[model samples]
Target: MGWQIAAASAVVVVLAGLTTLALSPLLGRGRPEHGGGPDRDDEILRSTLLVAGVIGVAIAGVAGFLIARRAVAPLGEALARQRRFVADAGHELRTPLTVMHTRAQLIARRMEPQDPALPAMRQLLDDSRVLGEIVDELLASAVLTADPGRGEPIEVRALLDEIARSMAVLAQAREVQISVAGPPGVWVTGSRVALRRALAALVDNALGHTPPGGWVQLAVDVRGEHVVLAVTDSGEGLAGLDPAELTRRFARGPRAADGPGGRRFGLGLALVQEVASAHGGTLTLGPAPTGGARAELVLPIRS
Candidate 1:
């Protein structure tokens, strides 16, 4: 990233210098030189200015490039360290999560139906499985964005239905009803696993804010060449909140501090936005007409 910044600064500097050099003398091109008199001096001055401008532009460009690289070096290092940490953590946790999931299944087999802890255990199993999926996904795609064309075509509506079913457990625990409510036959082209994880993140975030007895909805809307997967919740609306700021990394809403310990501020929203961008799409957040928050993940429809 630092190198990229430096390179961009250098290119901008070069372009500016070239433009000045190419156009400066032309400003007085039609005028005649009177025996190397004042007009000639004007020409000389312009020439001098042109030369000096080039030299100054070159020096400034080099300086700017170096400064930009130095300023952004720490950020580059931080990003590298973060990627390494994610890769290492994903690799290390993959085995344990699989084992945990298998053990949960084993426990489920041994437990009686009437066991009071059955529900919690089942939730644990689901959580472990989802964690494993996330880890596997992180391992497969270590970057901030995903490769949308790496998989076959996906039946989007059916995928959303499955996601709703998977999230039903979480919604039930929260006493919030979650459902897929939209036209069917929606389709897209992307990795099923990646899309599934991103959509699940959207629904999970909605369920987190929705109060018990409230409802969460996943609806699809098609506009031109793009399709929108909108998740809305009947919790408190986004009063006095900036939708753009909330989508930024590490950003949080008003109720962020009051949420569960597992909540990572706006990390989920950030990832979803990244996914949307990768798939030639965008993410929008705003108030829902139903007096709640709405998040829209819009992607290009499969042609």
Candidate 2:
């Protein structure tokens, strides 16, 4: 009876060791079914461990994905809210501002030539017009952000010609000669209105900073798959700036408003950059070979 009991205990220890060896493969550090052992229970234990480990890894992966989604959602929502606010405010102010400007103009016209309030009223009207332009720019920017599909193809030469002609009087007032040069048949795909706005901004910047008899040149080139437009201004070049930063929102150069012949508002170049981006293009600022600042817009041609 004592020998049988000892034999039984030895068999139990051997079976336990075989089971642990089989499960080591499921722990990912060894081969399964080692040594040709014929233990059915060992096989069952190893299979169970393999399944549980796979399930644990799958759960961890899913949890990681959910955490990433939660982190990015808020940022996307915040951007959407910002664009919405700008669009709403711009739309709401348009009509009232138009009415106010008209009233101001009528009041100024009725005033006597020597009226004390005449100059102040005229200045107020001018300020109102500038504000209206700013609001319109904001609205256009917001719309472009919300819907990037609003752009269409436009003839390059015709558009530049129109902008140059429209600004002829302003250039004359500043005694700056505005000129345009480009291929007659060249074209670009973009929002005409947006392009017009961007070109107008460049021309205004040129006329504002250029001295009398200074020349501003508008040139366009179609090379390979790009439409390049350049606005060159003959004035004191940008000082103490990298030139690249001029495209950033509200970026001001060393010759900013504090210097002679600079615009009070710094949104002109920013708007140009935005327009370029909306049309899947790029805007760059550099020193013109003709001895002044140059703004370049390069748009990709549709394949």
Candidate 3:
């Protein structure tokens, strides 16, 4: 489009200049020589051609800008619709997944360990729970991508404690101890739901990598003008994997896909990173002191 506009503008300018020159001689030919004959006519022609060229270029530029904007408008609308669809689909799936998980758990409770169907029931329950988590992550990603988060003061310590408590059951089932530690009353500004989901993703990723009987820790603290929420596990730290690469959607480390929790879809860390950025924060990944991976979501402390 740009090239075409330039070409057309060039052609118009050239034609205008040619027409002015062609008319100059005729217009000046019979005029009195003393009345500023051909020389004055030539000056008028040059000035007219120059003005015409400027006007033509200006018009072309304006047309090109409007054309480019029009061309991209539909693409923007399409992307927005796609994000909305993903978010809506994920939200709608949550209820059914919760129902299925509840039913599967109820069946498991009624079945004897020796029953032939017990294992299958347990597997179904696990699958349903994992599926629910995936849906939640999907919704989080869609929301973060589509809209900027509303930053409001959130109680950081309480949030971490809630997450730790909620995830305790899963940690125990995997024989990995999970703990939370933080000072009280520390606050940050961000969307509470988004921040909670980000923390959940970090904890889930940590638990997935930690070995049986290993420990995972969630800690919140204030450092200078920032609030930090860190999730560290007792698993092998990053294993020489690039932290930046792991933050990319669907990018996983070497052991990320080989855990007992089954294969991770690799959206967890990516969602964490997105949430952090939306809240004017940073997500850092590094080796923990205890030889495990440490993921930190750092946000500016709301004054």
For all candidates in order, the CA lDDT equals: 0.77, 0.77, 0.80
Model 3 pairs whose backbones collide:
none
> Hey, what RMSD does candidate 3 come out at?
6.9
Poorly placed runs, candidate 1 (over 4 Å):
1-39, 51-128, 143-148, 168-178, 205-214, 248-267, 274-280
For candidate 1, lDDT tens digit of each residue in 1-303? 567656666766676667666666675575575465677767756775777577767776776767777888998888778768877999999988889899999999899999999999999998998898888767555543334465467788888899999899999999999888878887887657777878888788778877799999988888999888888989776766888887788887655546642233468778877777756778888889998888888888888
Cα lDDT tens digits, model 2, 1-303, are 445445545554555556556665555344454555546556656675555555545654555566567767999899899999998999999999999999999999899999999999999999999788878867767776777555566888888899999999999988899999978877676567678889888878877777888999898997799989888988765654677767767777654564664433377788788788877788888787766778889987654
Q: How big is the positional error of residue 151 in model 2, measured in Å on the Cα after superposition? A: 3.9
lDDT assessment of candidate 2: 0.77
C-alpha RMSD values across all candidates: 6.7, 12.2, 6.9
Q: Which residue pairs does candidate 2 place in steric collision?
A: none
Ranking by TM-score: 2, 1, 3
The number of the candidate with the highest lDDT is 3
Q: How many backbone clashes does candidate 3 have?
A: 0
